[model samples]
Target: MRKLGCKPAVTRHNQPRLSGLRMMARKAPARLVRDHIDPAPLMLANDQIGDCTSVGIANHLRATASLAGYQIDVSTGDAVRFYSESTGYRPANAESDQGGIEVDVLGIAGRDGYHLDHGTYYPLWGTVDPQDRNALALVVAGMGCAYLGVQLAAADQAPGVWDTDRTGDNTPGSWGGHCLLLWDYTGLGDNDLVTLLTWGVRQKATWQWLHSRIMEAHGIIWPQMVLPSGFYPTGPDLDMLKADNAAFLMGNLWQVPVTS
Candidate 1:
């Protein structure tokens, strides 16, 4: 594992915590599971939900995303609405810090060093994860780039698809409350998918559900793979900058299947 050195969020991988693992063993409907042979990605893009956590995660991710010239498409407020399901912009149930948001931010950090996407995470967070929305956020008090709260995701809902390896069945993904980090998108990216880390119990359904919903148009997502903190010298690289160490950055996403 990569020692976070300064980035606290980068500590853990997709591994689950002790208590959390036990909970899954006890609650997950493993016996009721009906296996799928050649699985097809579920078409459930119209049902994305967010907890107060995503608010923080999106804020920091917006910075990293900006570095990759891609946005994470997350928000729960009109000030930075990126989707119809956005917090208050919608007519159905506009709320704040709901969760499940994607975003895009930019940084001309030219001489000003690292600049966070005010458009994507302005009222949100900067210099630190304000409220534990993302892994980095959890380490707000620290100088590193990661934290425990950010490493945790709420928990297992129920596996809606063939997630025998993780979520079981008939559930909305993982259901529980735990911490996570934003590391290891490396593996998922290799599989043409994105990966994140959590200090709490790791649940495959969390990402799986996010994937299914994204494909279903339930929320904003990238058809292309979203990898963890890595290097793409050809593109905007945030991790390389030292002068802008604590500053923020932004990026844009390509090939996004949008309804609008």
Candidate 2:
């Protein structure tokens, strides 16, 4: 797990600002997944030191705007600056330095307004229950993406490979606190794998790994963005339906129904 650390103060550089343009929200597709989301136009969160937090936020903002038919690329350097301004932390002195918090990154989004070619994005804060897979799935399915702070083990840091089978025994060791963007979820039950946007690529992690490694999770709710076109029942949703059907059947209502 990566522990949070502030970057040392340094000379700041000029960065691009968000455009104040706004666009109309269009209806989303009936379903979405890693494959369903075209990766081409989406901005990649580069692998930089002490900047995972900014990358995560930038990716989320870009994805939200893209879904609404807009092209928006949030500058990671600007995001870092925003983080510094909001939290009173010094700018990163080096590329490998570790720093940032989810709240501060979100504060920047709220303050400046996430602008896009089509429209601006407004994020709604929501709790992330990593232990509750169904809840996580619902947020991702309904909201498009979730931001997560995870403790990564050595095995978890393997580049270009699906990180699975992580356990609690794996210590953070020298790894510092890190953040990333959760874009999609696939499969069900014990086979579930979360698709995360990190290091400029989409990575995978099993539910087991996520439950064990995730220290904090937050849903980036974009009110201006449209929800999925169709309903996708989650584990709890299915369970509730099953319970309702059983209750109705046990009441013997079907045997008595014919009034119409």
Candidate 3:
């Protein structure tokens, strides 16, 4: 069985929501994953450590960077380092290897910033309702991708169109808590199909399956994915959101924007 890392979704007291934000692009394309990128999974050391939470973030950073006509070289060591720092996991201590909470990890990264090869990137993430499909689509269209935490079913281990498994071990969280990046979507209406980057490759799953298994979703706005003015390239008032996040989080959490 693959290692599952995400612990669970911890609700914050005053997290920002995208419900009222004005989206520059009302509709997202049927698909967002670029054709030039390879489907080969990076794995990012998740095969050995329960660091899917950090691995998911690393994958998003790479995907967004690639989509924007550049590259960010992320390594397994980077992922494992972030995981160890954020979740208190030690390579020599098995007891400290107990996964991590997705929101907590993101919140910490948002406050302290994540160090990458190029430089430190301060990613601004907000709570997104998993049940809101339109909101999710807008996120992918506007923010580039969505970070998702999901409960894995026993049948999910087989992989290939992770639709509902009626005749098998389909119980939510039966397997474990896992995390993935939702980067693309196709089709229309209830039949929409979404592509997830996880466990070292891209996987397809039905919208229904995502709706059923998803426990938490967040829209992450990478520093490099935005315009020079600190706004999202798609035109969301990212500066305003950042200001709100600064206040909602800790003391001057987002006092300065990281343009490097």
> lDDT score, residue 47, model 1?
26
Q: TM per model? A: 0.25, 0.63, 0.87
Residue-level lDDT tens digits of model 3 in 32-66: 54456553447988888899999888888877776
lDDT of 1 at 216: 12
Against the hidden true structure, what lDDT does model 3 obtain?
0.76
In candidate 2, where is summed lDDT lowest over 10 consecutive residues?
Answer: 15-24
Question: Candidates' lDDT values, in order?
Answer: 0.25, 0.51, 0.76
Models ranked on TM-score: 3, 2, 1
Give the higher-lDDT candidate: 2 or 3: 3
Q: How many times do residue backbones clash in model 3?
A: 2
Please give, for residues 1-260, the per-residue lDDT of candidate 2 as tens digits. Answer: 22244222121121111111011122223334667554322222234345566666667766665555664655655555544443444533443243655554554555455554445555544444556565566556555676777776666555444445543335642355667777776664455676777666677776676776676666665545554424322344334433433343344211111111
Highest lDDT against the true fold, candidate: 3
* Residue-wise C-alpha lDDT for candidate 1, range 65-101, written one tens digit per residue: 5434555543244212332223222434544323322
